[model samples]
Target: MSGKTVIARFEQGKETFEILVNSDLAYEYITGKRKDPMSVLDAEEIFKDARKGERQGEEKIKKAFGTTDMATVVDHILKKGDVPITTEQKNRLMEEKRKQIIDIIARNSIDPRTNAPTPALRVENAMNEARVSIDPFKGPNEQVEAVVKKISLILPIKFAKIKINVNIPPEYSNRCYGILKQYGLKSEEWLSNGSLSAVVEFPAGMQTEFYEKINNATQGRAETKILE
Candidate 1:
């Protein structure tokens, strides 16, 4: 398959430098999926010269990057990119991330000072104050660790995972099955009497909210057990 391309650029004061590499590799580096910044050079094709000696080709690449230090050039390339995302697109992405952050907090975190679930509004406000940076291309769950670190400065938070066993009576099984399925139901069985029993796993922070939801859907008739 053919490879994709991307241009990385650096500008400081009055000087500018640029390098070209496989777009996939550049994204891997940008997203922390690739550990070595210099790896970009392994796939580098910017200095193609069959007639020139290796030393000459190296010199040309360095000159093009305006630096002899590979590390410095890699740093510059990583910081700047050729593709530009629009402001509107950025705002929409931030909004989506903001909601994800709020949902995570509302579901998984409690105010240590009060031992109560932190309100979504409070989390939103704290996130805004912290000026958290959201990666538009990355899923919120994937970015949660860094985001939590930043927001922790403004709010007390903890993350936990929970597993639940739910039993829905025949009267409610059909009505509540769909809701339970969305919460990561692991295994489910239909009892002889037409009841439904399911084991589900989800983040602990969402436990209270999820319980309330399941109860409401089943009119407090569903039985639940927190396994973890």
Candidate 2:
């Protein structure tokens, strides 16, 4: 890992525990990719004030973390604590999460004007210009709505779902049910004639692709209607 040392801090009832750690490995530990917390630390000592060189007593460490075992205590501190990160590292993480945020928006949302998915490049451009900020630690899915809201003002965007009534010929019913469920088969019924009638709901942006799949599956014989 990067050998750059930094402090990871966590506070309990009346105790604050700090550990000096390698910045890169500390992140991996917190993210659970690293199983051994001690491997990330620069020093084996816990401290009430690391910068002051004031070491914490074992009793206090045990009281604050339940067990004074260094590895477990270190795990708690790194996972539940605030770890200092460099500006460059923070920006790099935000950029990666930025792409995830963009994918979520582009996949599930559509341009209301055309009822189609906006080009991914357009969404990326909107993100660069949007005033919203991305949280490096919080998941990208959690940040998508706020980012979409900000970008919506500049792009004709809206989150939409399309419901469809689909009828499959008897020959294709068994074959097409799997496809229906893949998109979202809301409900289904078997007609007396042995064909399948299903209600499907999926993202509005998938309309073109959905049509392509269903038509291809039935050799252009599947019939469907938009629900309103």
Candidate 3:
């Protein structure tokens, strides 16, 4: 595994530093799986000999990073150096994220002018028309807002946050509870009369489909109120 380690090089002014980290850890850091890339470095072991006045580990780290401070090395790795993944791999990852964003928009957004859910294709087209760029390193949730804002300029769109209060009779509560949970239940309670009441929030684009699911589960026995 040591032989498969990745080297990150950083240079400032006339000085240069090379840091070693495991290939897997480097990939994770580059892909946002790990928040800090330096955490992957075995800093403790590198400083272990320093505590005993040997300075072997410290010297080696200093030689690699120009300083023994792991934080500085981590920052440099983040700001510079190419990610170890290939361009094709990065493109595939970005494409997957782009699909996820499209799915989210289709499920949660609507055309304000028409008051109807936006079609997935239209949303995708709008994204392209607006020239929205999805950050390969960011999760869909983190990047969707900006993407939506850009697309909205080309289409009359809005991502609606809606809340609904629902009540289910005892006979349907057990079966319906699971379905409701998938829609983002915020809070739930059981009534003394053996009923289930809950609050759920989800994208308004899903309202019709969600209502149909709830209605079918409860056989029209569920009462739902859209809370303003």
Q: What is the TM-score of each candidate against the true structure?
A: 0.54, 0.67, 0.63
lDDT of 3 at 82: 39
Please, what are the lDDT tens digits per residue for candidate 3 over residues 108-222? 8878887677888999999989888877756798888888888887877887877899999988888998988999999999998889999999898898788999999988889
Candidate numbers, best TM-score first, in rank order: 2, 3, 1
lDDT string for model 2 (41-72, tens) is: 89999999999999999999988888989999
Could you tell me the lDDT of residue 65 within candidate 1?
66
Residue pairs that clash (backbone atoms under 3 angstroms), model 2? none
Candidate that beats the other on lDDT, 1 or 2, i.e. the better one:
2
The CA lDDT at 205 in model 2 is 67
Where does the lowest 10-residue lDDT sum fall in candidate 1? Answer: 47-56
How many backbone clashes can be found in candidate 3? 0
Candidate 1 per-residue lDDT, tens place, 1-228, comes to 223554555544444445555555665565557777777654433324212312224565566566667666675557453433446645765677668867876787766666556778878888789998787656677777787788888898776567889999999999888888788889999999999999998766677778889889988989988784
Error (Å) of candidate 1 at residue 112 is 6.1
lDDT at 56, model 3: 34
Clashes of 1: 3
